[model samples]
Target: MTGRLSMGSGQPIKLAERRVFSDSFKPLYNEGMSLVERAAEYLDGPGRVEARKLSRMAATLYAAESMRLTTRLMQIASWLLLQRAANSGEMTRDQVASEKSKVRLDTASAPDNAIGWNELPEAFLALVNNSLSLQNLVRLMDEEIYGRNAGMTDMPPPRRSNPVSDQISLLNTAFARG
Candidate 1:
């Protein structure tokens, strides 16, 4: 899935747009969107009730954790949306690439041992953990597809002067560039 596609013809994938349209990307898109919806539901419903029970210090921590979880999910959703746009031809790959620069894929979670970490509800913690995992997966998949450097230009190798240099060597021995 990370590399070129092959259907037994043994050729490298030539269509650049295939990065978004590939079959492997579909499941990831679905998973990310599902997580986003679930997180929103939990935060607005049961999460509000659970937060009221927290001690002052733990309540503060819960607020921070919820923010992080929301931020992480939003970023993942943004990326997935961009890819979906490309998949459906709503936007060109070039447009997606330009817009993608704003999507941050390096979100991180607070340490498990942080002061009030143990006070968080198990369900809330589970959602945070799941979002973190999905974020990491999306980041890796993005890196594999787009590469480590954004807007990376895969320039072809410099052409060789062997033929010209050979001719030159034949005519004049010491001045060849190859």
Candidate 2:
């Protein structure tokens, strides 16, 4: 299903038949998957030992944060897999669009001033931070590609300033200085 998206100019831009999931997306996908795997390993190994040694409040926070981290990673994985499916033509853009609704892109934030935050295991904190970062990246991409949250209306197109001409102007100025 094709739809027109306005780019703040009241002009309707036709959605392209083929979406370009650029080479950059591959790195993001890889990073997200790697983070997920690393988080799993840590949670199963070092994280478990660390959690057991935590104070009562800290242990509770640890459980909450770890669960949030896992949920965030799952969402990221879902987004990446959906994009890969669309890229490979295993799934159509329309199919991906519909399936996108099922993935929860919104992250659950931990309380900013939680009592045990300072006492949480450093390794767990690192994993949580990394997962949150990945989640944000995936969420941005989802909004951009899927037009989530009226993102099409909110996002402005990148401004172009004729890079070749700009380069030539720079060169002219440099040569004139000599």
lDDT values for all models: 0.73, 0.68
| Model 1 alpha-carbon miss at residue 164, Å | 65
Model 2 poorest ten-residue lDDT run: 151-160
* Candidate 2 accuracy as TM-score: 0.72
Name the best candidate (by TM-score).
1
Lowest summed lDDT over 10 consecutive residues: which window, candidate 1?
152-161
For model 2, what is the error of residue 73's alpha carbon versus the real structure, in angstroms, after optimal superposition? 0.5
Across residues 67-97, which tens digit of lDDT does each residue of candidate 1 receive?
A: 7789989989999999998888899878988
Predicted candidate 2, C-alpha RMSD: 18.1
Index of the highest-lDDT prediction: 1
